[model samples]
Target: MTETITGLHDVADRFDAFLIDQFGVLRDGAGPYPQAPAELKKLRALGKKIIILSNSGKRSVENSVRLAKLGFDEACWDWFLTSGETAWRMMAAETDGGARKRCLLISRDGDTSPLDGLDYNRTEDADTADIVLIAASEGDRYDLGHYQTLLQPAAERGLRCLCTNPDKVMLTADGKAFGAGRIADLYEELGGAVTWIGKPFPDIYDQAKIFLGAIPPRRICAIGDSVEHDIAGARMAGIASILVETGIHAEASPTERAALFALHEAAPDFILPDFRL
Candidate 1:
């Protein structure tokens, strides 16, 4: 049975640290959630260690800048980790040792900063590329079908895809839109090998453990709005989770929520309307 609560304050005393998701939990596409920064400050004031563990494939410093511009102060959390930064580090450490690695990148507005500082060469032609990297998308304006022509050929060549954002859909202020995970799914269906990074994957959790040090998993709580990503990811990492009802699942009925947890075979320890600390 899952316990439904109003906010993080209800169970704040139970955990020594918090691993929070950034998208729906902290902000939408347009801007930060009105109460998010202050609520995080409250948690910080209580001396709880906080880490912003976002599935976003954007670099950590870029995320920090974005958050700062959105009115969030850096004092709210101890550290920040993003799947994009993780991907960049892994790719940069690749031992291929070639002049430059070629990759086909799927990104938003042609932003290629995630691949910056790496030895990878970006290519518009997928057939000649060594791998595929999905960082972002214009989901609100484009559908999955729009990417089929590009992915189909790569899939047939058995190209391996590295998806930074593993969220199928993201909740924005305007509405829901497809994410990089959706592109990864399409590539898989087309016969390409895919490495979905970020939430719901064990690799990110392993990386997070490096930052959390001696704190046992039970003493840490992961708060997010997506059950498929946040809740399931926390479960995989052996940590407690709190699913906020404000993101993609905002409109889900009680029965629907039950079905989702049952479907994923992973339920959050608690549920909240939002992260109002």
Candidate 2:
């Protein structure tokens, strides 16, 4: 029974800390939401702890700079974390015992900063690679179909795919763009094993607990646009969630939204029209 709500103001008093998503809640790709920064400031003023949790494949610093450029200063939030940062640290520690030392990297616009300072060898040929790591998509021009040729061969080789970003799509001012998760899904369909390291996986939420202190699950709320990612992640992590309607599912009607929640089995405690606090 998810209740549709006007905004976070209706429930802000019920939680002491907030785990917020960046893509659709805070800003689209173009810039910051008109009221997002100020609303965050209000929450902070009310003594609420806020952490920006993103499924972005970019590192923490890169995302910080991007947010700053979008008119959100570091003062607006207490801390920020990204799936890329978590995955980069995991790879740096060589946590995956099954993955080989060499990896075939799939990325966007030549951004390979996640692999920087890591000992893993990079290869262009998937045949010679030990594993496949997808950090980003090629953007709007490409879709899941465009990567079939690349993933099919790797799948046949039985390569393990590590997807840093679990978001299937990202909504920005320009439009929706396919993400690494879409390609990872295709690989799985082709029988390739995939390790999703971001939202809905629980590892990222555990990492976030470090910043959230010892706040109980009931006291924390996750606000995001994706049902499969954000809402499902929160449910699995033992925290409440508020599904924002204006982001990924902006075009979905009430019936479609209900159907999505049912399909995912991840109904949020509340449904917000937008991220207006």
Candidate 3:
């Protein structure tokens, strides 16, 4: 509701574009925020080039369906890209140009549709995979054992651990949900390393902004909750960041807030007291 612009607006205004985060900024996983739809709609009327860069691995089509179901109209922005889609592309690119490779994935039940051609394998087949990829898959049966016995091998052998979503958890309409960040954490705890190919990372931001087709990164306004990822990522990318204090660490203690602010050395330009938009 306030027009407080950042001093770096000159350099950050290049794209006139926006690459918004999903969970904390726009809505809490439960349903669309009361003011998010309107905020986006107003931005659209202002002719902002926008892209929904979600960490969900199923790609933008899935986001298209989910966003609408969550009350976000496609007309509000120009593009929508997901970490799932980005993860798939990264895997496909790393695979042998000719030889087919197997993949051991922990995906949701109905979410395996995007991973069509790649060979599917179980956790036991960890050694066979050219890459170890993790997404926000079905977690009903997912336990620490699977990682300890199966996926650990893939990571131990130095196979690339790719995380589609780098978020540890999110409170959706149903309840709190675990994403690839948790899985990645498990692997890391087991002495495995990974490369998150999407947001909070620069590569995804560059790709999505470029995909906005002529839009510059400075023109984009980044919004989200995770100071470690969203806010820090925006600072590194030199874009304006808006912090929504309505999810994740919303009830942060004073020490927590200090650590969050100190994590980046730079503070957010805008802070939404609640996830209203």
Q: Using TM-score, give the best candidate's number.
A: 1
What clash pairs does model 1 have?
57-84
List, residue by residue over 1-277, the lDDT tens digit for candidate 2: 7888897889999998899999888887777778888877777788888889999788888888888887776887777888999999888787555544777888877787878877677887777887889888875767667688777888999998889998888774578887889888888999999999989897899988877888888999999999999999999999999998767888999899889888999999999887887
List runs of model 1 lying over 4 Å from the truth. none
Per-model TM-score, in order, reads 0.96, 0.93, 0.83
Weakest 10 consecutive residues, lDDT, candidate 3? 1-10
Q: In candidate 1, what are the lDDT values of residues 2-104, reduced to their tens digit?
A: 8988878889999998999998888887888899889888889999988899888788888888888899998788778888988898888784776787889
Worst 10 residues of 2 by lDDT: 94-103
The model with the greatest lDDT is: 1
Q: Encode model 3's per-residue lDDT on 190-256: one tens digit a residue.
A: 7788888666788777777567776555566776777877777788887777776767768887478
Whole-model lDDT per candidate? 0.87, 0.85, 0.69
TM-score of 2: 0.93
True lDDT of residue 51, candidate 1: 85
